[model samples]
Target: MFLRIFNRCASTATASRPTSFTFPQRLNRSPTAILESLNSCVQTDGGNPAYIFMDDPFLIPTSGHEKRQLALSKAS
Candidate 1:
């Protein structure tokens, strides 16, 4: 169920652009934590293949520091 929705949303995403998707529940985790989890999920050896196949990475910034970091990363 979750995968279907996520796949549909992810399919429309492009690697060269920034897109946003909102989940049902608010996330309580930190941006770094979320990124780490996603990073692990995309790994080839021990990861969710569904995420590995995503065209672009997901970025969820939940704090000012994370927002700034994301902006800087994109700028460079």
Candidate 2:
């Protein structure tokens, strides 16, 4: 349901563009706009813990060992 609505909105937004932008140009310009749109959507839904953590990194584990493990896994 959310994906359907998101797809519709994305298609509508892309269809209305008047410029002949390439795919790469569109991709580069999309992140900020997409983030703003997602933020608004999630805000309305009262945001889940996962999304909340993504925006505020400090909410993640603070223990030195845990941080080191996470960093090591991410590096690989």
lDDT of 1 at 61: 58
Candidate 2's residue-wise lDDT over 16-71, tens digit each?
A: 98886656543555648888887878744453333323534764645667666666
RMSD (Å) per prediction: 23.6, 15.9
lDDT by residue for model 1 over 1-76, one digit each (tens)?
Answer: 9999998778767554657777798768876997898888884765333332343456555467766776677669
**18, model 1: CA deviation in Å?**
54
Off by over 4 Å in 2: 20-76
Evaluated with TM-score, which candidate comes out highest? 2
Q: For model 1, name the residue pairs that clash.
A: none
What TM-score would every model get versus the actual structure?
0.24, 0.25
Candidate 1: clashing residue pairs, number: 0
